[model samples]
Target: MFKKILIANRGEIACRVAATARRMAIQTVAVYSDADTHANHVRACDEAIHLGGSAPKDSYLRWEKILEAAKATGAQAIHPGYGFLSENEEFARACADAGLVFIGPPPSAIQAMGLKAESKQLMEKAGVPLVPGYHGSEQGPQLLQREADRIGYPVLIKASAGGGGKGMRAVDKAEDFAAALASCQREAINSFGDDAVLIEKYVQRPRHIEIQVFGDTHGNYVYLFERDCSVQRRHQKVLEEAPAPGMSETMRQQMGEAAVAAARAVKYVGAGTVEFIVEQREGGDMNFFFMEMNTRLQVEHPVTEAITGLDLVEWQLRVAAGEPLPAKQSELQIHGHAIEARICAENPDNGFLPATGTLAVYRKPLAHTSFQRSHLRIDDGVREGGQISPFYDSMIAKLIVHGATRAEALARLDAALAQMHIVGMATNVQFLRGVLRTESFSQAKLDTALIERERAVLFNQEPLGLPLAVAAAVAHTVLQEAEGAGRDPFDRRDGWRALGAAVRPFAFDFHGETHAAQLRYLHDGALYLQVGEVAGPLVIGRLPDGETEVEFNGRRHTLRVDELGGTAYIFGTQGATRITAIDRLAHAGDTQAEGGRLTAPMPGKVVSFAVKAGDKVSRGQALAVMEAMKMEHTIAAPADGTVEELLYVPGDQVAEGAELLRLAA
Candidate 1:
């Protein structure tokens, strides 16, 4: 076994690798950028080295800098945990030439499978099942359009070198092909530095299932199992599970064998995943087509670990050290069902737009050890004061749970999700809880359109849970004040005064609406409370666990309450409700819309403005493009207007809601 290694990534994956390396008694080195100077990953390893700027291009993507960091730290091997240089062929070759072991597949395998266009060609000859599409080298727009038409409408244009759901577009008709292709190519070049693409038939009802395949230097290969990654938004996975719910034993063997064959075709070594697009038919049958192969560890590998009770990262180190496979194909067996939810820092209510800010209130549930097969596990490297910038992926953490059955797994997942508390920025925790409760997901009728099909229930904005939260907040404040108060009248917070009865007013904002509550302290030591139209004699107390218990007219309610800064979080069986305490002394201003101003939706760099000043454009016309979090967002004209001014040119970073352009009616 190697004595030391360098992790060439950051965030959750970096910390994850360090954990395994520590367990194996291997010293680990971490590299960080300017933005992540105090990041958790930097503190995770045994030692650290500084990279360049915060941007990926200046830091993580700079292979030479990473190599030098490894050399300086005296790392024997380089573990490219997931993204960045994980699948870079040139980097792997460079590591080998520099006398450092690359803890992944050989450079030849990465080069062969790195590009989807060429990989499909390799798969076709290797007898792997492929979908009907175009993977040729022709770069002409007309040629690609003709190929799309040939493959029929509703085709997918994917980046030849793309992963993690970037640089992909779906065109339903020929008229939309050109614009979609251009957008896809731009994202491809930005994300993968390759403008080449491939066209394939987009399955209407598709479920993304990928097999976890591992190979060693001794020509030994095995497939651990499959994970269903169907629940998605914008072609990115939100939820993934191991031992696919409806997978038959026969199909499981077939897919596993096929995946192993693909690995063998590449003379593969180390950990890799072969993803397939499974078409769910009207009856019950399924047909899977080859999608692409990820040449590194997958983001959702925890679920596989939970089911198989295997350490994938440890396997990678052993394989790179020229060790044989740990277990044979027959020894590998699925133990139980596992589910993993990717918790991201984004607003599901706003088209899942990535949100960036300090993690003012970050919380997680109880975590089990890496080898602890069942229960809860949280993989993350973020802290309460950490900043989530637009320089990388928007994922905050991953919550994984295992159980004897899928129902139990789902129950545990939902409960664990409720335990997570996030503030200072928008997150999808509530959205993920809502998704778990949807009929399609609850009943296991999952598809890529599950979120869209159940939007009505998933996006329910009814403020029914606000009352408990309000009561909890009031109860907590009263309890805390009562503890520190003596006989002093001014220190008493029970609306006390020299008068007969004193009234205390409290206000909080929830979901853009402000609600007020009044508490009256009577001379008889009883309290009267009223929130909106609901009024009653209230009795409240604090539980030993710091939870608040409140009663209104003999109806008792217990809730978990936590306050950070001025934000109060209440978590109950109905999910979490965050309310901001309103400061009455602050100045109140008139709320009005700023018309004819085009603003950036989130913090990002301006890619380009399609229209300049004095140019007339129609409503919903593309006005500007903003790149953030490794994806490009198009800013469109709100109405028919003439462009008046451009606030920032291409490559200028803009804050969220910054005015990008001025439009005149």
Candidate 2:
């Protein structure tokens, strides 16, 4: 085995690779950008090297800088942990030329499967099943449009060189083909530096199932079953599971053999994934078409690990060090069912726009213990006080659970999602929980449009009722009192009322609305609170473990309170309620009108502008597109007006809430 390996990536994958390397007694080196100077991945490695700027193009994608860092650190191999330069054939060749092993597929294999257009051609020669569409080399718009017409009205225009839903568009009609193609091409060129694209017939009721295939230098190959990634949004996976829900033993073997054949076709070595777009029919028959092959490890590989009891990274290291495959195909067997939910720092209610901020109150649920046997796990590279920067992917963590059966695994996942607590920024935790509880997901009736079909309930934001709001206020007050209890007895005052002058007035803000309440200490030591039309007398009982128990109206409720700065985050069975204590006196004259100003919803760089200064646009018209967290968000006009000023041009990096433009009102 190699003595040291350099991880040419960051975030959870980097930490994950380091963990396996360390377990195998291989020292790990981590490379970080400016934004990740103090990142968790950096701390997890044996040695750390500084890359360049925070942006990927300035740092992680800089092959020279990464190679230099690896050489300087005396790393025997460089592991591209999925993203940055993982599938770059040039990088793999450069590593080989520099006398350093690239812990992935050979350069020829990567080149063979790197481009969608070329890979389809190769798959066709290999006799792999493929969807009927256009994979020709013609890059003309008109030629592509003609091909789309030949295929059907509904066709998919995808970037030939990138993954992760970047530069992908699904057109439902011929009229929308041009705009979709242009947008897709723009994103393609911007993301992958290639404007070439491929058109394919859109599969109806498609389910994304991928096979995990591994090959060694000794001409040995094996398949680690499969993962069902059907639950997706915007062409990206949300949740994944091993041993696809409706997969039969025969179908599994068929797909597994085909995937292995595709691997052998490319003379593939190391870890690779062959993704398929499985079309489900009403007659219960399934037809799978080859989508594309990912030349590196997949983001959802943990699900495969959970079910197969294998460390894929360890296999990669062994293969890269001139070792044969760990096990043959016959030896590998699916142990149990496993599921993984990707927790992202994105707002589900806001078009799933990526969010960036400090993790003020981040707490994960307990892992599975020997006594508990819960089989719950959390894979993350973020800490409680860490910052979710805008320069990288928005995925905060992945929650994986395993059980003897699929039903049990789903149940454990639902409970685990509920136990997670994250504040300071919007996340998809609640949204994921909603999906898990949905009837369709619970019954395994999954499709690519599952989230869209259940949009109403998935994006519904339950109102923070008065009871929860009041509980937050009371919890905050109780915590303050407890802190003061250790001080002088004379300073420990608990809402003392002298002459009934409205004891203490407290203001709180929830979801941008302010509310006021009055609290007083009753003669019997019970606290009385009047919120709006409701008046109740409550007793706050302190528990030994710092939990607060509220007794009101013959009902007792236990609450978990985490106070960060001035915001009080209260957790209960319903969910988490974050309320900020408002200072009425300090904000008496802070009423500002928000009109005629177009502000950024999040931090990102301006990708394009639909309207320039002095241009007349209607309400809800697309004004600009911002790229953040590797996703694009369209900013629209709030009201019909003339564009008076365009504050920032394309390519400018704007902070969250930064004003992009203003209209003449």
Top-scoring candidate (TM-score) = 1
Report the lDDT tens digits of candidate 2 across residue range 359-419. Answer: 9878888984211123887888999889999999999999999999999998889888877
After superposing candidate 1, which stretches have Cα over 4 Å from the reference?
Answer: 460-464, 480-487, 553-555, 589-593, 617-619
| Cα deviation of 459, candidate 2, in Å | 0.9
Candidate 1 lDDT, 1-665, residue by residue in tens: 99999999999999999999999999999999999999999999999998899999989999898889989889999999998999999999999999999999999999999999999999988888999999999989999999999999999999999988889998999999999999999999988999999999999888899999999998999999999999999899999998898999999999999999999999999999999999999888999889999999999999999999999999999999999989999999999899999999888888888999999778788888675596899999899989999999999999999999999999999989978888778889999988888889988897888999999887745433666667777777787789779886777766765669888999998888899999888878778888887788888887887777888745787777777778777776667777778887773664576698988899999998899889999998999888989878888888998999999989899999999999999
Cα RMSD for candidates in order: 1.9, 2.3
* Whole-model lDDT per candidate: 0.90, 0.88
The CA lDDT at 270 in model 1 is 97
TM-score of each: 0.96, 0.95
Q: Which candidate has the highest lDDT of all?
A: 1
